[model samples]
Target: MEKYDYEQLVICQDKESGLKAIIAIHDTTLGPALGGTRMWTYASEGAAIEDALRLAKGMTYKNAAAGLNLGGGKTVIIGDPKKDKNEAMFRAFGRYIQGLNGRYITAEDVGTTVEDMDIIHEETNYVAGISPAFGSSGNPSPVTAYGVYKGIKASAKEVFGTDILAGKKVAIQGVGSVAYTLCEYLHDEGAQLIVTDINEEAVQRAVDAFGARAVGLDEIYSVDCDIYAPCALGATLNDQTIPKLNAKIVAGAANNQLELDKHGDLLHQKGILYAPDFVINAGGVINIADELNGYNRERAMKHVDKIYDNLETVFAISKRDNIPTYIAAERMAEERIASLRNSRSTFLQNEHHVISRR
Candidate 1:
């Protein structure tokens, strides 16, 4: 076993139902872990484990950078969401969450919907991103898209010396959920759009709504544009696709965009400014974090809009220091987390180990 490189990971299997699941809680840099639950028909348990662990880690940084009190975590149910789901499966999963106490919290993500979240909520209080009717702020995809929009502006400022996105060619690789909302922002900014998605209806919607040109889902690589926005699934920027990109800046809301970790260096070498995905896509989590009662929409949007400030700073840092934007952003996030942790140790030395996760 590779023993997940993650800070904490627990794989579960319900004895009676033979249901398999993996819960990965990356880091509680800011507070107790929180993120979404994903159900997929992964080919292997190991693959499911890897995805959960990696996504959970992304959540940690995502929440920390967004200035949210919650930490990052993720759950993966390995089976078909349509056919393999049932009350027992979710309850069995809920029991797993109960075992973790409050170390990790789970909500809706990908294959998991609000109705599914309702099921898990019955077992524990460690949940977020629930429907507003259930006393939550509701789905976070729109806010996620909003954050990406702000990030796009920041990327433009770094690459073009202006936040105005008007007339800039933007290639969006997906049209689902966040992508549609993101396109609205891009269209309002007067950006030229070249969009694609595996779903035909979504592609048509983009073309009809924004006068955006539709490209084949797999052909996003060949599109000539000023920016490449991947709002779809992960691992899209691999060795094969990176070589085909015509865009100068790659900014998107999808998690784990780089197919391989080394792809960051590849983008840098290619002179393509890569906005860190976790940083750019922190909007959803930021919005969901508001369910803590006394939550304010205005305050959440303010934080979502703050992506521009953080990214603008990262752009400044990268340009001044001549470093890759991704590297610069990650370094900045790590420094902020370390500084917070250090302050706690200095003031509350005895509580150091309690707050710090080695």
Candidate 2:
């Protein structure tokens, strides 16, 4: 197994339930690692391991940039979410999380739901995004969308010298839970929308609701628009797609959007202002983190809204340092973690490692 300097990579199995999962803890410098758990039917173990490691590292950056006193980790279950989910499967998974004793907290992610989180919560207190009945935040997609919207505006300010999205042509590459809400915001702001998705129903919904023009999936990258929002998946800004993008600003709710460090350089050289995915898409985690503080929606959203200012800070650092925005964001996060690690060296007294007990 290849480890990328991650603090821990735990493989879990529940043979009776045919459950095979991997939980990757990237760092716990500032606090216990916190991130979501995803279930996917990967082609190979290597692919699943890669996803877990990458997502865990992304969460570390996401939490750090969000200014949360938390570290980064992620969990992945290798299976078809639609067919393989069951109470036993998740309970078994949760047992493994409990074994960590709060070193890694898990929540909902792609292929998982609040119900799944509720199941996990049954076995461990180190779970977020549970049902509101459990006094935890539910469904982080809308807040994630709001943060992405704010980031889009920030990118507009950087590239066009104005944050107004009105009269702007924006191409959104996915009409998922997050992007759909994002479209509503853009439409209300008077922006013309061009959208694409694999699901015909989702595409039709956006077209009917927001008057967004629907495009083929492949055509989304080539759409002539002011901003390109990739809400589907990560690494969409790789070598092949970067040359096809016509948007001046690239911002969306995907994690690890850059396929590689050099791809960010490619976007920079193309004069496309790219919002760091971890910074712009920190809303979901930010919203979930509020559960640790007593689940206040207003307070959580207030923090998510700060993504606009944080992204602006990243842009400033990018220009000042003459580096890619992604690098600038990483530098900003690393600096914060480094400084805080130096200043705060004491361990929490709690055995469960509660992040924000109120």
| Best model number under TM-score | 2
TM-score of each: 0.92, 0.95
- Candidate 2 displacement at residue 282 in angstroms: 0.6
Q: For residues 1-358, could you state the per-residue lDDT of candidate 1 as single tens digits? A: 2453356889899867657988887777677888898989998888898788888877877777677777778888888888988877787788889889989878789898877877778887777776677768778889999999999988888889888999999999989999999999999989999999889999999999999999887788878899999988999999889999999899998888998778988998899999989889988888888777545789889888899888887777888898877778777777777887888777787567667865
**In model 1, which residue pairs have backbone atoms overlapping below 3 Å?**
none
**Candidate 2 per-residue C-alpha lDDT over 128-236 given as tens digits, one digit per residue, 9 for 90 to 100:** 9999888877999999999999999999999999999999999998899999999999999999999999899999999999999999999999989999998998889
Ten residues in sequence with the least summed lDDT for candidate 2: 344-353
lDDT on C-alpha atoms for all candidate structures? 0.85, 0.92
Candidate 2's C-alpha runs over 4 A off are 1-3, 344-358
